[model samples]
Target: MTSTDATTSMFERIGGSDTIDLLVDRFYDRMDTLPEAKTIRAMHADDLGLIRDVLKRYLTEWTGGPKLYTPEKGHPRLRQRHFGFAIGDAERDAWMTCMRGAMEETVTNAAARQDLDKALSGLADWMRNRQ
Candidate 1:
């Protein structure tokens, strides 16, 4: 199903929790290995386990799936949570590159991919805290 199918949620259109987990995994894998992501990757812990779970929950909820995140972590307060990190243009771009790669690999629906691309780009740009 596609997001255009109003009967379906973005989460369902994108293949539910399993797909979200895979996307998060692919996203972090790219971030962990790509030279372009090295700077941003350095800000993360050596082990991605915790962040991976958090992201899975966040994405699940953000995509109109079950409200699994806020119940566990309260408000996302995303910008505030990321304030300590110096998220500049480079960081945002690298992050988007990873996400784009993941989405390309996992999301089969053209419209769903396009929708996510637009939404995620805006969200990533919003995360930038520096010039």
Candidate 2:
């Protein structure tokens, strides 16, 4: 499921920190406005500033760019951290809707986008806390 190797990381393929910032910002923007994302959107705070920063750091490290997340936040026990939220198919789809659009806009590399989509889809599905 990993995309990084000795040559280049998925982070570099998609333009590193700049792309991560754009992707996270766009994702939150969609979640804040999309009707289909209402259910999941309500799970976040009115000000997305904090979460946006967190997500950028998380994605940066996840894509092998830097250790921004873990150094500050510790191991990404993502599911555990999100256990307070009730996640299911609808929530997963809504999250993916936001993410796919953000990736399309920010991650210019086609192959990198596809690979990222696949990986993130699995992560979103695994985040489900309900049936």
Per-candidate TM vs. native? 0.95, 0.94
Whole-model lDDT, model 2: 0.92
Candidate that would win on lDDT: 1
State, as a TM-score between 0 and 1, how close model 1 is to the true structure: 0.95
lDDT of 2 by residue, 1-131 (tens): 24454477888888899999999999999998899999988999988899999999999999888899999999999999999999999999999999999999988888889988998999999999999
User: Highest TM-score among the candidates is held by which one?
Assistant: 1
List residue ranges in candidate 1 displaced over 4 A: 1-3
Error (Å) of candidate 1 at residue 29 is: 0.6
Error of 2 at 22 (Å): 0.3
RMSD of each: 1.6, 1.9
**Candidate lDDT (C-alpha), each:** 0.93, 0.92
